[model samples]
Target: MSSVPEDRFRRSPVPLITHGARRTVLRADDGVRVEALYEPSPGGGTAGPAIVVAHGFTGSLDRPAVRRAAQVFRQYAAVITFSFRGHGGSGGRSTVGDREVLDLAAAVRWARSLGHGKVATVGFSMGGSVAVRHAALYGDGSGSAHGGRTEANTAAHADAVAAVSAPARWYYRGTAPMRRLHWVVTRPAGRLVGRVGLRTRIHPRDWDPVPLPPVEAAARLGTTPLLVVHGDRDPYFPLDHPRMLAGAAGDRGELWIEPGMGHAENAAAETLLTRIGAWLVAA
Candidate 1:
């Protein structure tokens, strides 16, 4: 499955901010395809830390918000923003956050292959959950449609991460929308979709898959500071998700809530990046 030709995200004016090698990282995940844009470090002075940005659901690599964040990160280290499999240049169906997590691992490996050792991961929405899951544990092969183990795929990261930013944590599942989607995928009347062997009830649908919860994922980190940012008015994850994560991690993580903004608002909300950028100062 190649990337859908039409992407709705608007391109940001990043030329004024970042200057580097403009290329693409066309990669695959266990024969399933995934890819990212490669902007090599400005390659001078002290480019100590590298970063890889992940996009949210239904979002392509060039999503407007991601490009803007990539532009912001370009000033610090190498920036690689990629599309999950089934979204852009990559192949396969979008597995919501489950399979997407593997895509992030692939991107991280690509960054490391470029000689970037100390890395920082930034993910938004579904991407955020993937980042947290990968940081906490190694490959579990949730990518398989058959739910088999990919144990041979060992952890690639050094665990010396700078920081992890998960803007919105869609933790709860009993919410109105999720319940409806769950019913759509599980109800006997919804058997038509099942006949095609399609299952829309993903982890985000009132269920979480990782062995470690988001808080455990953050606290599981040794020294790498984790930043948990969420919008109080977020309609998707609701308001309490980040609070729960920060509360769970205690000193292991930091939480910030954006008032009056809802889900996906962190990407487009006013002064959103400023706060996120400030919170990202390598701890």
Candidate 2:
């Protein structure tokens, strides 16, 4: 796990084994190059379930926290981890949670291309919003949301989806963390900080037409099993966010409110991730 230059691997489409995973660059439907890692399950078969993991904003697939989650998930299924556009070795600037759906879509499609029969998407925080939106728009195989049954849409489908510590709506500035996050995405100085300090590249433009919120997206999941997990002690969005999502999903989704958990992948306990992996397998 020695640190190497990211430039050496960022643009290469060819797969190479690195740090115990198959690392490669995938071309997103929008032409953004997404850095990804594919790790087989312990049993070493591609026919079983596969999990595509989407890390939160400012989080990369190579981050220790994200990698840890992938490792734990691999116990139940093969895991595909990727950096969202503008994160890590990926190309393009982040539109925060808006256009990130395309990034998740690309990863999910790549998962199926790897020969995994069943695919589950697990996203944390900002990535959670992308997962929910991706599932609603493409998980049913119709891909009607993106206009038609294109390859990207077909590949974007997931059998199951899990969103952790995600917000229900956009432009929510109630919490201090969220307020600061908005500043990070909206201001030039903050964007510089994001690029230099966080190593996350952010797009300058705002959402042209606000994409569907997570709650609305949750309602459209259509038979795709959904799991909404949040922590009561979360510093960002509170229990109401998960409640709104779960409520919109109705019986199609299940909500787990962890007692002491704070937020996203960083705060997720090992037991919780293991349980989520089991849920993915059973769902």
Candidate 3:
């Protein structure tokens, strides 16, 4: 991979606040530029904790779905939302969910730097996979994804994690939606379509050593709290995914199988989002 431009990481003056939120650029330890937004809780409901939201594939912090989720989350606590690498204003090509862990770590660290005593992660679809892996790799002595660079950083670790509509293992082509998504990521012509039609950029290369799968990562979460949510109607992944995650999480995990829910953020209802917000507060 090519090195990111040095100017991408040059410190800028604090971002001008807009609509009660501050938008800024963050640099991952590996030098990827991650675009992030911080929104304080609207009222005095709760003041010390922050929830970092990670969006699914083809999603960006600028997308309406992400913005809506952030708005709902802020009702309970401060919210931090960001684009994963290769999405929106972020700097690198997407490695799908592999190296995206670094992007999430950067956002979590920023939430800590902002003085929030508690930080939790709520992720949708591909973001859910990233969230679980992040909690495992960044949690206290759980082991590191990037050598010792991201290890043992309590501030960077999420106190809790909620994975919604995520997959359990990689290379799952059992569903039509997932098969279509794979084509978009693996074929040159399909990648062109993703870039032109979907506004998503995918790296042509595959995982090197292959990071731990989401179920395995959930098992390694240790004392960290985990929530696995899936909908019976979700078209991408079946109920088996969430069940596997909850099983691996054992006593540390909670599973919620929604009745009519469909997929990720776009399909999530405001009521469900609020419930997720409540769960984070209680955590």
Candidate 4:
């Protein structure tokens, strides 16, 4: 993917979320930019913690599900959500779970650096991978996506908590057409992606056979309160995805199995909301 012209990403700021939502813009090296939405906490509360609601693969902060989750989380604490480059109103291309995880980290820094007490993350599908990597970074800091952080550690840290749905254990997914397509897309011909390194516009990379997936990293993330929610009828990842997620978290993870949910969508948003809110309180 070719880099977006400099002038393109420098456009006027856009409203972070609909309905008068406040906004923040974060810039990563190589001209990568992300949009963060900050919905002021209600009740005039100054010390409320923050929760980052991340979207799934091919998703952005503006996603209706993310927005709904953000609204739900806002009831408990301040909430932030954003778009990865090439996904929504942001810059650059997607890196599957690689470079975008770095973008997620940038968003995390923007939140925690503000002195928020507890930072919780709730992600769907690909976003779940982001929550996992973000949590892993809190304790050991050995994770990175896009071959930069290896950001596979899923379990999150003591101060950081995460909830993920339909997380793929092997980032590679290790199947036929998917693996072949992945290799074709991210072969990195000549080590200079159009002289690129994921910063060359909206490039996306699939799972590499190297290192560990986010689930594999869960074992090393210590005791970061984790919630694993998956629909038993998921068409793609299947119920095994949550089981894999739970296996990675071991005793530190919580599981919520929605009876008829499938794929990455919420079969019952109400049930998911109730369970997630309850989990945040328990943590």
lDDT of 2 at 208: 88
Between the candidate structures 1 and 4, which one is better when assessed by lDDT?
4
- How well is each residue in 62-150 modelled by candidate 4, as lDDT tens digits? 65555666766766777778887667778877666665666776666666666565667776776777667666755554434323333
Off by over 4 Å in 1: 1-12, 15-19, 25-29, 41-47, 138-155, 158-171, 174-212, 265-270
| Tens digits of lDDT, candidate 2, 78-144 | 9999999999999999988887888888888888888987999999999999999999989767777
- Candidate number of the best TM-score: 2
Q: Write the per-residue lDDT of candidate 1 for residues 91-193, one digit (tens) a residue.
A: 7765566666667777777766676656667777667777776665542323322234453233244232222234223434656645554454445664344
Best by lDDT: 2
Each candidate's lDDT (Cα)? 0.56, 0.86, 0.84, 0.60
Better of 1 and 3 by lDDT: 3
lDDT of 3 by residue, 1-283 (tens): 0011223322423222335677899988789999999988866423478999999988888776677778788878888999998889899888889989888988988887888878999999999999999999988733366666433355678999999999999999998888899999999998898888877888998888888999999999989999998888988898999999999999999999988888888777779999999898788
Q: Which pairs in model 3 have colliding backbones?
A: none
Model 3 segments more than 4 A misplaced: 1-18, 44-47, 141-143, 149-152
Model 3 alpha-carbon miss at residue 266, Å: 0.4
Task: Give per-residue lDDT, candidate 1, residue 129.
Answer: 71
Which prediction has more favorable TM-score, 2 or 4? 2
C-alpha positional error of residue 28 in candidate 4 after TM-score superposition, expressed in Å: 3.3
In model 4, what is the error at residue 207, expressed in angstroms? Answer: 5.7
Q: Model 3 — which ten-residue stretch has the worst lDDT?
A: 1-10
Q: In the order shown, what is each candidate's alpha-carbon RMSD?
A: 6.7, 5.6, 7.2, 8.0
